[model samples]
Target: MLELNFIRANKSRVIQGLKIKNFSEEDLQIVEEILSLDDTRKEVQTELDSLLAERNQLSKTIGDLMKAGKRAEAESQRERVGQLKEQAAKLEDSLKDTKVQLEELLLKVPNIPHESVPPGATPEDNEVYKAWASPLPELSSDALPHWELAQKYNIFDLELGVKLTGSGFPVYRGKGAKLERALISFFLDEATRAGFEEVIPPLMVNEDTARATGQLPDKEGQMYYVERDNLYLIPTAEVPVTNIYRDVILDAADFPVKMTAYTPCFRREAGSYGAHVRGLNRVHQFDKVEIVVLQHPDKSYETLQEMLAHVSGLLDKLELPYRILRLCGGDMSFTSALTFDFEVFSAAQKRWLEVSSVSNFETYQSNRMKLRFRDGKATRLAHTLNGSALALARVVAALLENNQTPEGIVIPKVLRDYTGFELLN
Candidate 1:
């Protein structure tokens, strides 16, 4: 959530940023409503404080009157204090209501884009930050898309998943299962080697954790909720891993807190359907290894670059052709101040599949989580960053498509030791 004070002080700038984000007229109106409610909150709180102060002063006078044996005067003062107390109570209720309204409106507002973020209304305008110099793989018509390859190899079972659960859920069998496990282990090992502490977080999180990570309100429809348990099935490990620091206060010396977790992510993916959504390209449940950092605001961007390089190194080791995109304002997420998407070129699919999104939320998430660090005598919201070290499904899709041969699917040399096999055929 944006700080109310910042919004109040930089209303015009905030509005301009929202416009760049492609906020609709109704969305912009929410901002105005928040400001109006804030104004009412301030007025109501001031009146409540005045009434309470008067009530306190009257009580003191009533005590004095009673001590002086002026029963009548004491009763009169008590009556006046009671009236003030009533007024204060009503004002307090009004203040609470106003605050709730303001907060709800604030949640509707997205994080302002960083100054470096380009202005655009869609992914088409996103800038290509980097592209591999190697030529994209050109495959013959004989090459099969990943789904066809999956059936040919008997690796993953979609029909079995449908029988067991529903569509969008897939079951990996034999080499496919091994490949998934190997990728998870590889990602976790890489993140650990990069100085991130490994964590095993809960698969389901309560409302607070989800909201703190900016997954709630905006992503409610996309999440799988357990009505009986009142817990949300986590869409990513980022939610639980980052929420570990909610309401936590750290010392300045804890400048960069790095953590990583691997989890089976669940998303409803409501209303999603198309040819591109086939096979491992998009799914309801998938495995992902996430990396998260809590850093000093001043150094968060530098930390972001370091993280970007870490992910880049992983792609290089796998020898996959990839590109990096600096997402434009409108293409960025509600919680991201700036984001870089890493897409791997799937040869047979003849398209780029996004496998990672590294983002610096600045103080957007920390502010909501109350994750602050004390800088000498002052405390401030720490900048939060998270990225998919890699989302497994798309990575799997790209790997199978890029490495497929008429004879067999070749495994990358780096994962050989983990998978203990060179081919998935």
Candidate 2:
């Protein structure tokens, strides 16, 4: 959430930013409505304060009158105080309602794009930030997609997954299962070596945790809810991992805090279907290793770059052809001030599949989470960032499709030690 004062003082800039994000007229109206509601709340609070002050003064006057033996006058004064108390209560209720309305309106607003963000309304407008310099591999005409290759090698079972759970949840077997485990271990090891402490966060979080991370009141439908317990199945490790510092106030010495976690993310992927969702292209459950950081506000962008390089290094090791995109205003997440998506080229599929996204929330999340840092006597919001070191399913798809041979699917050299084999056959 944006600082209410910032939004109020910069309405024009906020509107322009929202326009670049392709917000509809109805959505833009909420922006103005929030300001109006905030004004009303201020007015009500002022009146309540005045009433409270008057009541306090009246109480003193009533005591004085009683001591003077002016019983009738004191009794009349008591009636006036009672009236003021009722009015103050009503105004307090109004203030509470207005705050709720204002918060709901603000929640609908996406984070204002950074000045460097391009003005665009879709992924097509996102600029390519970097690209692999090496030539992409050419595959033979007989090259099969990951799904077909999975069947040939007995590495994964989709029908078995359907029988066990449902579509959009594939069961990995033999080499495929081993490859998945190897990738997770490799990612965690890489993150730890880079000074990130590894953690095992809970898979389910409460409503407050979801809301603190900006996942609730917006993306609720995209998550699996445990209604009886009022818990949400985490969509990404970022939620729980970043929330680790929620409501914390750190000293200046804690300028940079980094943590990584491997988790099986669960998502509803509601309204998704068709060919693009086939095989490992899209799934309801997938394993991923995520890196989250909390940094002093001034150092956040630097930290973001470091995270980007870390993910890029992983891709370089895997030898997957990939590109990074600076997300346009419309393509960025609601909580991110800036985001970069990394896409790995799947040669056989002839498409770029996103394997990672690194973002700097720049206090957008910290404000909601109440995460702050103290510098001597002053305190301010900290900046939060997180990235998928790599999401396994799609990365696996790219590997199987791009490196397939007439004999078998060759594992990336970096992963050979982890998998304990050169090929998956």
Candidate 3:
């Protein structure tokens, strides 16, 4: 959610940014509509203030008239006061309605992309910020994709998952289950070593929690909702972990508040059907280790670079051939001001799998969450940032496909200690 004052001041810039994000001309008109509604709100507020002041003065006068033995004048003043009260009540209702309308419209407006964001409308338009310079892994002609490999090795069973719950939910067995646990542990250890405090948050959140993180009304359809409880299954650990600071105020000393968590994310990948969605390429439930930061506005972008480095380090340790892409405006998330996606090459599948996305939301989420830090005498919204240290499904898929030999799949050396004997045969 954008600060109304910012939008009022930068109307043209906001419109241009929205246009880059592929907003239609019809949607661009929302900016003008918002301004008009704001004008009405100000007028209504001014009238309400004046009316209350007048009523207060008249009430005092009525007391004075009664004390001076002027009963008729006091009675007349009382009648006028009653009429003013009725008008005030009507104005209050109107003011409340206008505010509701204003908020609804504001929610519809997405965060404006940063000035550096490229103007484009699709994934193909995204710039390859960092290309893989090293040679990609090569597999033999008979190399099997992760799905076939899983069946041969008894790693995970998608068919059994359908019988248990539904598609996109795979049941890991034996070594596959152990490998998943190892990856989670490895990511968590890496995050903590880099000064991030680890947290275990609930997988489900209430409406306020969802809205505070910009998930409501925008990506609502992608979330799994529990109507009976009015709660939502979180799509990422970022939701619950970031909400920890919602409605909070902090000190300047806490410039970069960092935290991390591992969560089983739930997403409704509706209408997704293709050869690309095979195996662990896409799933309804998947494990991810997320890192979140709350930083001073001036240092937020700096913090973003640090986050990117951290994710890159993780991929490097895993020995995966990967590249980074600076997402184009239209390919970015609703709340992200800027984003960089990391893709690892799956040798057998012969495709790039997106395994992580690091983003700096600036004050987009902080404004909605009312998360702030005290700066001298005033409070300012904190910048919010989060990224998948690594989403395990694709990473696992890439690992199995790239490391497969006639004997077994070789686990990365860094995970050997965690996985014990990690030759998943």
Candidate 4:
């Protein structure tokens, strides 16, 4: 959400920024109209308040004049008070309507972009910030995809899972289960080493948490809801972990607050279909290690880059072939001014799977959370950033798909110490 005053002051510049995000000029014109309503609201409120004050003073004067038996003066004051009451009441309604109009418009405006965000139109517009040295792996013509490989190795039971629950719930078995555990531990360990405090938060969160993280109003369709509890399953760790500081006032000393959590994120993934949803690409429940930071507004972009570095380190350690993409305006999420996606090459699946999204939301989430700190007599919302340290299923699929050699599927060296097995065979 944008401040009304800022919108009023920077209407043209803000509109240009919105254009870069692919927002229509007509939608921006509507915002400008809303700004006009805001001005009207403030003006009416000022007038109504002044009238009320005058009416109160007149009432007091009328009382004193009546006590002194000055009938003429008391009568004149009483008449003015009656007219003033009618005027104030009418203006009050006008003020209320103007405020309502302003609020509705304010909520409609999206977050502004950071200076570092590249101006572009679609996913193709995103710049590649980094790519690992590892080359894409080659497999034989009979090479089974990750889904087939899962069955060949007896690692994943998708049919059994769907029978027990539904599609997108695949059960891991034996070493596959252990491999999942190893991935979780490895991600958590790496995040910890990068100065992130570990947290174990509830899977379900209240509506406020959802709203604060910019998930409620627009993402209700995308989340799993527990009606009896009136809570929604978190789409990402970013929802619960970031809400930790909701309505909080922190000290400046807590700057660059880094935290990580391992969670089974549940997404409804409604309407997803075709080749993209095939195999390990889309699932109802997935594990991810998320990294979040609350930093000084001026340093949030820097912190976002730091988070990107941490994710890059994990990918390099895992030796997964991957690329970084900067999401253009059309692809950016509602609350984010900018976002970068990390896609790992799934060799067996023969595609790039989105493994992580690192974003700098700036004050977007913090302002909604009411998360602020006092810095040199200035109190303002802290900037927020988050990224996936690693999303397990996709990376696991990538590892299985890419590391498959004629001998067996070779495990990456970094994970060998943890999984206790070099190959799935």
Alpha-carbon lDDT, every model: 0.92, 0.92, 0.95, 0.86
TM accuracy, model 2: 0.94
- Per-candidate alpha-carbon RMSD to the true structure: 1.8, 2.3, 1.8, 3.2
Worst 10 residues of 2 by lDDT: 270-279
lDDT of 4 by residue, 218-278 (tens): 7899999999989999989999999999998888888989999999999999888677787
Can you rank all candidates by TM-score, best first? 3, 1, 2, 4
List candidate 2 segments past 4 Å from native: 24-27, 56-78
Cα lDDT of model 2 by residue, 230-325, tens digit: 899999999999999999999979879999999999999988888877789999899999999999988999999999999999999999999999
TM-score of 1: 0.95
Given candidate 2, what's the lDDT at residue 344?
A: 97
Tens digit of lDDT per residue, candidate 1, span 25-53?
A: 77788777888888888888888888888
Off by over 4 Å in 3: 56-76
**Residue 139, candidate 1: how far off, in angstroms?**
2.0
- By lDDT, rank the candidates, best first: 3, 1, 2, 4
Summarize candidate 3's per-residue lDDT along 1-425 as a digit string, tens digits. Answer: 99999999999999999998999999999999999999999999999999999999999999999999999999999999999999999999999999999999999888899888898989999999999998888899999999999999999999999999999999999999999999999999999999999999999999999999999989999999999999999999999999999999999998789999999999998998899999999999999999999999999899999999999999999999999999999999998999999999999989999999999998899999999999999999999999999999999999999999999999999999988976989
Cα deviation of 300 in candidate 2 (Å)? 1.0
Q: List the residue pairs that clash in candidate 1.
A: none
